[model samples]
Target: MISTEQLAGFRYVQDLQDQPAALAATLDSLEASPAPGDMADGIVRGRFRRVVLTGMGSSFHALGPLHLRLIESGIYSLLVETSELVHYLPALVAPDSLLVVVSQSGESVEVIRLLEAAAGTAPVVAVTNTPSSTLARESQFVVETRAGEEATVSTKTYVASLAALEWLGAVLTGAGVPPVLRVFRSACAGMTEYLSGWPAHVESLTRFLEGVDHIFLVGRGRSLASAGTGGLILKEAAHFPAEGMSSAAFRHGPLEMVRPGLLLCVFAGDLPTIGLNRRLAADVSRGGGKVAWIGNDADLDALRVGVSAVEALPLMEILPVQMISLVLAARAGREPGAFVRLAKVTTIE
Candidate 1:
């Protein structure tokens, strides 16, 4: 069993515990700063032909929900990684397009390169944790996540960015800020209630994860945010090999790899696809792989994240994966989220 002392020794765990407060602070910042009037007006007036969302790592994953929202609202939206956007798709940074860039540090190499390439051609909306970074200073509008300093692998910053992006999506889509704000507050409370049981969660996950050598996080819709980010953090924090992909995509090819010693954590996403996700989980189990269903109705208590609103589900879906990370770290006898080779910010390309 992982000891409380061991968990407390890592700054990463502390950051994980601090997420609810970071989320609350992000909501407060959103209320205080509001979306830029010109940007919102341009979006509503159709002055911009498209919206391009770009970021790296967890920041990129956090844009999944917003990208879908914009598309559903009939606004053309492009989701691209900052690196690929700078090197392969520079033309997308035209004045006719609006860019939404997310970065915790805001000074990562690709972000800096993109900012230089854009050169004020497009109106940039920056959703970042560092208020004073170049991405914030150079952008036409800024939504500060206010997640504070993260010691290593992203926890607070990722959720904070999600909150900020949700607010941004509501503003750009004219979806009414009051409702989104209410969801944000609810998500914060939900996160606190869920995280309050982290120790027990970790202990329970330790048993579920035993003898597991492979991990995959799969979901659809907004839950893609958690799946993608969860896979990234599992590797970064626990030095474990894992993959995150869409549920449909998994059945396409990766499903063949399912067998004993493999664990699949499936997110029962929004209502439209929850039934499909449940089917996928059942298939994985029948194929002899362990399945952890992440949802309110999960059979395993360790996997159940009690979320009220569908809007709040994405934020809560990630908690189970975080618990798994802790368990993986303890099994490997390493300090979770302690970097052996990576820095918090990527300075090199």
Candidate 2:
């Protein structure tokens, strides 16, 4: 198990510890700014033919829940990476489409290119941390997340954007804001409670992850947000090799990769497919791979995350993965989230 001494003072760890406060501040910002009522009305009246969601890295993965919510509400939503959206699908940026872009830095190279390519053709709604950035200044609508400055990785900004996106989803779907605000408050409280025991969580994960050389995070439904972002952060922060995919996709081919050194972290996502996720965990364990089932009712205490609403699961589900990253970084004797080659913002496409 990693000692508290080794984990202390890392900027990424500090960022992780700041998530609850950042989340609260983001919620406060959302409450102060009213939802874009005109845009919501336009969507309901079919002023916009479709919603295009795009971002890069964690920002891109963070759109999972919103994309699903938009589709479930009967809106035609396309989830695309900004790089692809800019290079291959510029036609989707027509005036009839609503573009929802998530970027913590707001000024990534692809985002800059996208904004230039868009050239105000579509009404853009940006979920970003930088209020003065090009994305915020040029967007027709903006939801700024108060994640403050993140020195490394995407701990606070990613989660804060999730909160903002959740509120945006509620407004765009005409689901009302009060209920989503309540969920946000509950999720922030849960994050605080969980992070308070960070040391124990890290230690427990250190033991649970013994001899695991690779990881696969799998889930269905909204939990895909965590699975996707979880894989990204694990590699970024710990330099660990990990992959995230839908649970069903795992059964098709990657399931064959299961072996003694492999760790399968399965999210028992929303009830619609929780049974399948649970069965996948069992099968992976039976195949001699280490299995960590992540959910409120997870069999392992180290992997359990307290989830209140299914909507909040995406926010809560990431806590255990954060702990795993700390453990893996400690095992590797490296400072977690210290970027060796990458910059915080992608200046080059």
Best by lDDT: 2
Residue-level lDDT tens digits of model 1 in 124-217: 8999889899999999888999988899998999999988898898888888888888988988887898888888888778887888999999
RMSD of each: 1.1, 1.1
Error of 2 at 110 (Å): 0.4
TM-score between candidate 1 and the true structure: 0.98
Global lDDT of each candidate:
0.90, 0.91
Candidate 2 vs. true structure, TM-score:
0.98
TM-score versus the correct structure, for each prediction: 0.98, 0.98
lDDT of 2 at 66: 94
The 10 consecutive residues of candidate 1 with the worst lDDT sum are: 1-10
